[model samples]
Target: MTDLTIRARIREASNATFLADLDGEAVVYKPVEGERPLWDFPDGTLAGREVAAFLVSEAFGWSVVPPTWLGDGPFGPGMVQRWQDIDPEQDAVDIVAPDVAEAPDSGWLPVLEAIDEHEQPVTLVHEDTEQLRRMAVFDTVVNNADRKGGHVLAMPDGHRYGVDHGLTFHVEHKLRTVLWGWIGEPLTPDELEGVDRVSEALRGDLGRALEEHLTPQEIDTLGARCAALRAVGIFPPPPGHGPAVPWPLF
Candidate 1:
């Protein structure tokens, strides 16, 4: 890999994230040294988790996650992913006024209704598309703990990519996201096949690849999650014990 030249710090990110130029191409780097220790996750593991998520995405062959890998950066060893050119006019997920959300051809499905800072009612919604639906399924397989609207990148060609996957692959049922519009809906035949691919790969090369990033227990639980999803064959409901969506939905 080409040496990364730091361009700017992404200050809005919770961890030390940087915009870098890799051989004239832009990329995002999240160094392990800058990761804030989480109460539940072990220190220095977040970078590995990011790579692990990418690996799982590849196993599913959905291109849901961008090309990601571990590399040395200005800050040190970290997770590095190719930057995506997002479309400013597109949003795979969004928050809209209730009236707009209720339009017959809005092309969005409501996930949650809430009050904004102006004391106005708004609805959390996502595009009703097979692309976004695949992402929702991908999130479930990875046990994504935070799937904020901003993490979803909408490309000009209509492809959707998911980023910020550090808080994922937990053994616990910590699934949380704004992509709950398909709750209880049966998985399409293609979706089921995707899940089956992950499950089969887990028992072979994919599981072995993940050992570099996740613990044996975490990998096992990931496989279990895949098997369960395949057996149930539906988008799961939000967990009862915790907030179903991440704070600051975007």
Candidate 2:
């Protein structure tokens, strides 16, 4: 922990998060000791879930999530992830009023609409990019319950990185996200191949690695989700039972 020094407190987070200089490299650290109790996820498990998400992203070869792991920090044991310096001028997801007229064309997908501060209509939109599609697939596999607009980071090199995965990989079907644009679209050859690779990995090493951080039941569900996605060969919409989108999207 002495190797990592807190550079700043990430006040936007619900739990205590800090930007730490780990041996001169910047990393976002989420301390498990600072976690707030959740009704669903077991106590002190969110940090593990964040690392699990990173593992899944790496195993699937989607590379949607940044490198992350469980580690010791100034606040104690928690998740530490590589800090992605996103382009401030651009966001992969946004909320734009319908009358804004100047919104970008072609690559944008309006996932849902809501009322703005003035009680006017606004639409929640995300870019229709291959990177985002891979992210959506990864979210389905991990059953990410909190994929807000802010979680999708647009990097300087044009790669999109997904962060804030503390609410993921529950045994239940809890895949709420802002990335519903590709629902009902047929999966590409590369996407199908990615699913196959993840399914196989889950049977062996991936499953074993996840066991350290997740319950057996949750790991089983991850395998099941991968198999189902491979069988369908298409991006499926949210199931009828639960809410499909996260609130306070940004």
Candidate 3:
């Protein structure tokens, strides 16, 4: 659906969430509070979080969750979004085992590893590593600050999808995530094509419409990321360094 076409009723949600029902379908919402421990962060973090997820999803032509509406919030009126039905067991695929610790590579590990809560296991099995790498690219493009191990999900059919984008789009370059499989590797030809399609889409009406919701700096940064990815021909080296990987999956 178009970004503007998603309709959901805004209900009362906790600081971490803005509750809403998507088109009278299942429940759909986004966390209102950007990320916990907000002392050192940026503005519009809450909105930026959801927007970043949607932007990345659209750019890559995936079913990325979108913010449906806007309403009054603890900080003020913010965007409303459709909530994803995360089956605790089914959704998570990359989280590593916690109690038993790191065993053989037969299980999923936490791909997004910095979340405050514990709901899924994040591990890096041999099969899921490549998908994790692709997700890392999407995270970098959006500047998502919180790509915890548990945020990456495995659909029943084994397709991986990234979620929980509440900390994104800071003025700073604080891109953190757990998928380090491609740190030194280059982008594949198909991956490069995906980046080009996204870049082209951004320059069209989609980017102009998104500009209304995103700040000038944020929008420009999005463009810059697309351009950079197209030219890099490879993943390139990590620019700023804090931690390329996320926290412990287990």
How well does candidate 2 match the true structure in TM-score terms? 0.95
Tens-place lDDT per residue, model 3, 12-70, is 32244434434465434443543454775545556555655576577676553433445
TM-score, cand. 3 = 0.68
TM-score of each: 0.98, 0.95, 0.68
lDDT of 1 by residue, 1-250 (tens): 4478999999999999999999999999999999999997773389999999999999998999999999998788999999999999998998899988899999999999989899989999999999899999999999999999999999999999999999999888989999999989999999999999999999899999999999999999999999999999999998799889998888
Clashing pairs in 1: none
| Number of backbone-clashing residue pairs for each candidate, in the order shown | 0, 0, 30
**Per-residue alpha-carbon lDDT of candidate 2 for residues 166-199, written as tens digits (9 for 90 to 100):** 8988888898999998889999998888888888
For model 2, the stretches where C-alpha displacement exceeds 4 angstroms are 99-104
User: How many clashes would you count in candidate 3?
Assistant: 30
Computed on alpha carbons, the lDDT of every model, listed in order, comes to 0.93, 0.87, 0.58
Ranking by lDDT: 1, 2, 3
